[model samples]
Target: MEKYIEIRGTNLFVKYLNPDSRKPTIIFLHDSLGCTKLWRDFPEKLGNATGCNYLVYDRLGYGKSDPMPTNPRPSNYLEIEADILNDLLIKLQIDSAILFGHSDGGSIALITASKYPSRIKGILCEAAHIFVEEITLRGIYEAKELYKNSNLAERLEKYHGNKVDILFNAWVETWTTSDFRNWNIEHFLHNISCPVLFIQGEADEYGTMAQVEKTVAQVKGKAEKYIIPNVGHTPHKEIPDQVLDRTIDFILQLAH
Candidate 1:
């Protein structure tokens, strides 16, 4: 069975797999609009495929976790997230882990690896946003319009529960912030000190291919890239089987 524990006065909904395996644990973090449930069964499939222990959880305000307060543009959102992660691991008796994060989760994973290199065995990032771009802002503006009219919000509400607005607004508002436009975390990439796999979709609408190309160019570490030909921002969800296959093979390489 899986396990869960609270951290910083919030319920962190976490699921653990392969309890008997000595392999490095994989901690999966969802995208900006994603919650644990939105990932569907990819984590479980990958866990069994790689034979490594796996964990998947919702961030505060997403999925079954507690709602987050407004104003998340902290200079230390990532720092605080990393701290909470360590606390959660300690509470659950887990030490080392490989973080697999998507979109915003991917950014968080990068932040954590840069700051707490010792705790991470590796990191796998998919469709991560490094810096803001005009395309990103425009896409977010369209999303805000969708939230006002389309059934997307209602559909997503099923995954985020009553805190749907909190999750959606946090993502849209933060990225839309004037000060956040110049935000770039590339400076911290060199400090990762661990193997990384970067995956991006050729058709990712929210972020440009240029950002991923920049990461491929700048990150001074063992990093590999796999760009899906015909997918959107959420490749893991848009094309799960292809991603699952690529991820399983890549993660297994670290086993030995």
Candidate 2:
């Protein structure tokens, strides 16, 4: 089901799959340029296979949600996003759920778990950065060049509409700026009490194993990691079968 939810007085788009199931909900957070629509059929596939309810939402300034103000964002924006997520879950009566986040979404999940430990049953992070990396800065720079010279904006228009420019700049301009270079979330990792699974691509241009290892080392609870060979940033999209198999096994084990 597709619906519009009000979070912090902003209208955000949400899509639910197998919402009535008795299983715990699996909430998916999208990457920098990602929205609910970018998730495509992954949620439906996961929901059907696991019989778990799935929730995918667009954060403010991306997808169908309201735009962010045209100003520089604070380094702690992910922490702020975590707080907003907590409010959304509470308002929707989601007592607790497993969080599945990718890239920026993954960082948000980590912050959320650290800030609101009781609200998350488990967490899975893919290409989630704990701190800024030189590789990350280079990736964003290349992506900006691609957007400027290619049809990327036109393709992204299908999801972002007129907000594409705002959305793209919000991610690129902020991350590449020197003021945000030292951004890191390691301080919040120790506060997380739930089990966590970190997934990364060995060939990822945006982050290194340090991103995954650093998070796993700092997490207070049990943590597992899988580094997929021959894959880039987004493993769920690039290697769905492996991701689904691994995720299903991990999540089902949490039930016991």
Candidate 3:
């Protein structure tokens, strides 16, 4: 069943699909410009497939959550996300979680997992970016061009409300900047002490297998990566059944 919970200043709109009683809590974090709606039915479908506690929530200023007046810097983001997520879990009375994050959300998951090592059961990072790359900048530049010519803004507007500019510009301009190239989280990867499963599409436009490979090399835990062929950035959305199967198998192994 699904219901809405109210945050002190903002209403926390929630969508739950199963009753997870003592099962590992699996929290789904959306992509860079994704909301709960963008995930469509994956959350519910996966929830039923595993019968574990599945949760998906919009980040502040993204979906139903309160929008911040400014975009947060990358260095400050992971910690801030961890703090906010800790608070959110407390409000929901959940003390631990198994997180699944994609793209930017995957970075957020890495941050949270590294910062609060004791609060997580496992982590599944999909299309996660650990360092900046030339291809990344080229892709962002292409995205900016496409957003101007295509309905990218229109499609994103549905998720961000009328202030699409507030969300889009910041994400684009920041990552592609000359200064943002030095963005690296390899130092923090050592702090993550739980099991981690890295998922990435072979043809992901945003990043390549290195994102997952580097993580497997750095993190001092049981870590592995699954690279699906002929898929793009949003593998779960593009290949739902395959993604569900892989995720289910991974989770089941952890369940033991």
Candidate 4:
């Protein structure tokens, strides 16, 4: 069911798939430009595959949630997002959960797992970045061009509605700023005590293998990596079957 949950003083849009199930919750976090709807049917599919409940939400500034201030976002915004996720879990009475996050969301999942280790069961990070890379900037630059010259805004409007421009600029302006060039979150990786599965596409334009390698290298608990060839940044979207199968296997293993 569609619902609005007050979190961090804002009504964040949320949806639950298989909420009646007695299985563990797998919370899905979207990318920079994504919302609960943008995750498409992956949450339902994953929930069925893993026999888990699923939760997906739009952050404060994306989807149907309240818009954030247009001021430059901090480099620690992911950390803030992690805290907010924890708050949402508490408000929902969820004691522990598995996080499935993509891009910026992936980074947030990692941060949440590390900073609030007691509540996280496991994490699945897809195309998550631990440090800024030159390719990331280049990809952002190209995306900015697409936003300006193509129907990118129109396309995103299908999912984001009127909040498309604000959400788009928030990500573009913040990431492309000079101050954000050195942004990194590797320090928090070591604190994560839960099992982590790092999934990346071999052809991801925004980041390289270093992102996954560094994540698996530093985490204190059990960790695994899966690099899907011929796929770009969004594996759940690009190759749903493979991503689902692998993800289900990982979660099943975690259960044992």
Q: Which model scores highest in lDDT? A: 4
TM-score for each predicted model, relative to the true structure: 0.94, 0.97, 0.92, 0.97
What would the per-residue lDDT of candidate 3 be over residues 184-254, giving only the tens digit for each residue?
88888998898889988898888877888899888877998888989998889889899889888888777
Ranking by TM-score: 2, 4, 1, 3
Residues 61-105, model 2: lDDT tens digits? 888888887746777888899999999889778866899999999
- The models' CA-based lDDT, in order, is 0.82, 0.90, 0.79, 0.90
Provide backbone clash counts, one per model: 0, 0, 1, 0
Question: How many angstroms is residue 189 displaced in model 2 relative to the true structure, after the best TM-score fit?
Answer: 0.6
Model 3: residues >4 Å from true position, as ranges?
1-12, 71-75
In candidate 1, what are the lDDT values of residues 102-211, reduced to their tens digit?
88888888888887787788889988877888888998999999999999889998888778887788788788887777788888887877888999998888888887
Question: Of 1 and 2, which scores higher on TM-score?
Answer: 2
Candidate 4 — what's its lDDT?
A: 0.90
Off by over 4 Å in 1: none
**31 in model 2: Cα distance from truth in Å?**
0.1
Please provide the root mean square deviation of candidate 3 (C-alpha atoms, Å). 2.0
**Which residue pairs show collisions in model 2?**
none
